[model samples]
Target chain A: MTDRLPHPLRSDALDNRERILDAARALFATEGLNVPMREIARHAGVGPATLYRRFPTKQMLATEAFADEMRACHVLVEEGLAEPDPWRGFCLVIEKTCELHARSRGFTEAFMSTFPEAMDFAAERAYALRSIAELANRAKDAGHLRPDFVLDDLILMLMANRGIHTISKTARVAASRRFAALVIQAFRASPQHSPLPPVARLSPAAPGKVM
Target chain B: MTDRLPHPLRSDALDNRERILDAARALFATEGLNVPMREIARHAGVGPATLYRRFPTKQMLATEAFADEMRACHVLVEEGLAEPDPWRGFCLVIEKTCELHARSRGFTEAFMSTFPEAMDFAAERAYALRSIAELANRAKDAGHLRPDFVLDDLILMLMANRGIHTISKTARVAASRRFAALVIQAFRASPQHSPLPPVARLSPAAPGKVM
Candidate 1:
């Protein structure tokens, strides 16, 4: 009976935290990281005081909001490293990472931007890159990836993948899949001449026909 | 003497117009299409009244500023069509066009955005696409381009190209060149396994090392 007295209040606090994070992720994914804390609070149906009490700064909120995605990124790299075939592993990482970024503009911005103050985030990013570089070296040694493939090529491909804009999430993913396939083909050491994934309707001017 | 009386006024008007366009183009290229008319007037050393009298609206200013680029775009297509090898012509168009867009963000936004009121702009874009479609057809018929290539693939490539962000114009163009080479390889019907262009420094996190 004595412990039960505090249970409701603790659960309420947990609920508020979840709501705040949900709102933050949705807003950030859609509108980007520029969304104000007050707007986020409003969306989450919490007071500014409660929001600030929980997250003191925008960066803190962003880091917390993207924590899940950051973990997923790490997991992706780990999965790629686990694959026995280095080329297939490298391709898997690129395709999955591109799809992940394509689905969330805010995550892309956060990952790509240099956050000087966020040392942990920076470390995680470096670790991911180092792992990928190791994977790439293995692929190159196996004579699967092109000899000239550079780490910068992955960055270049990611930046290009980020440019994909579609009317719907499905369209974006579809477009990303095709783009990744093309990039993989480009990165191949030997020409397999595989048929590309079907084109996504990305033409801005005309809707009926692409040209 | 009566006819010559208005010569100074006409020349002054023409000079103001040129200054306005020069300012617009510079700002739009560097800062994008969101720079205000007042800021543009200030940059041009012209009064707001004069700027408005010259350009009427932001769209007019943009259209006028980008006229030379538009003409250059047309000339690039024409030059591509003049090439003896249809495959070479197609590659040339893609490479040059990607470079063009890489150099100017404003031009890309203007080109991609559907300005419902800008009928002439739409018509010009249509003409460009149709011409490229004709070029693609010739390339495919020559068995140079992959059979599965569709016109939307070009749009997809352009959109992907637009994702390129670099610290300098040179780096951006370099990155675009590498990207174009990769795309061209991906689009080839036969795997040439050609060497890729040199990598550009595009890593946002570590400047000294890519990975």
Candidate 2:
């Protein structure tokens, strides 16, 4: 496997590809996906000709850039899980999720605009969430969390806090942290803490007219 | 106020309007909203002229149908709240929501296709949810439920559980019940029960991809 590794030429090409993606992420973050290919190439320290030779299309470059950000998120969660304390581990994981969501909000909105159903990305997401949920459950069973908590509810609720990204950066972090801590407290194994009020029933607006 | 009650003629007209809406709901459920005005009038035991007078246009008719169903859901939750147990009340409310969702799925899809956002509907929905959440919180405070729970989490998770609908009705109900119980257990202020797995992260797919 070592002997079959890329020679100097292939290694140089690989480095250029990485650089292009880096440049695309920065550009996409700043100027967005429609930014000129020439600009991206310039930012990457490569000529437009070299950029096309690598990605062949702007969509390819943008996709790669977006995927790189997602890959970084996966790495962040992995690192979070490496923490010795499961409570700390889970907190770090959720916090990392909020950070990534803030950065990729534009990408997410854009992606879903074209794919209305969102099932394509939903597949991979479902798998990852299920895995993490299992881990959270294990921690709960081990007495790290309150027993009545389920991972599925927390995941959707946290992600559904889409309002968090719209907040100011400093406030965003504070809000995200508050949201995480609140959910965590709700997961406690004991009823030492107070819960929120119960939900009310919706009234029918002249409901007798249910045609 | 009693002396100022509507004249008999006005009362008769109001009854006719309600009759028309009922016919519209049935027709929309069976044949959908594209059905001719004559057909709806026929179903309502009135003439096309009457439906037009009551509804004004197709959009108004559709909105009325949608609002009618939502109002019915509101009633179900309200009635459920009178139940002796808070858990039962929550379950009853969710069950009604699922039933309404099953019926309104087509109507909502058609409506949203023409108008991308339903800000009014969403706001009303959030308002209704806030009420339900408050009730759940009350139950928790009363030591009737686990302390670690969020109402938004439960609602979102239920919405996400579309798969359960594909199964047999009995099975679907059972699954929903179990799902609710699991959430309730997770919210239980105890250490013996286990927390559910981690929340699922949605995959932000590339646009133009649904599956």
Estimate TM-scores for all models.
0.83, 0.46
Q: Which stretches of model 2 miss by more than 4 angstroms?
A: A1-62, A106-141, A145-211, B1-62, B86-91, B94-141, B145-211
Clashing pairs in 1: none
Q: Candidate 2: lDDT of B24?
A: 75
Candidate 1 structure lDDT: 0.75
- Candidate 2 C-alpha error for residue A15, in Å: 18
Model 2 over residues B1-211: C-alpha lDDT tens digits? Answer: 1123455447777788888878777766545455787888898899888889877876567667677665775687676677777766765666566545445433433322323323234455555577678667767776766565666445433433332332333433444444443344445555553453333222121112100
Each prediction's interface RMSD? 14.6, 13.1
Quote the positional error of residue A168 for candidate 2 in Å.
Answer: 9.4
Candidate 1 residue lDDT tens string, B1-211: 2124544558888888788889999988866677788999999999999998876778878888888889889999999999989999998999899889988877876776556354346567777888889999999999988777777678778778877743356667777888888888788876543332222222111111100
**Per-prediction share of native contacts kept:** 0.38, 0.00
Highest TM-score against the true fold, candidate: 1
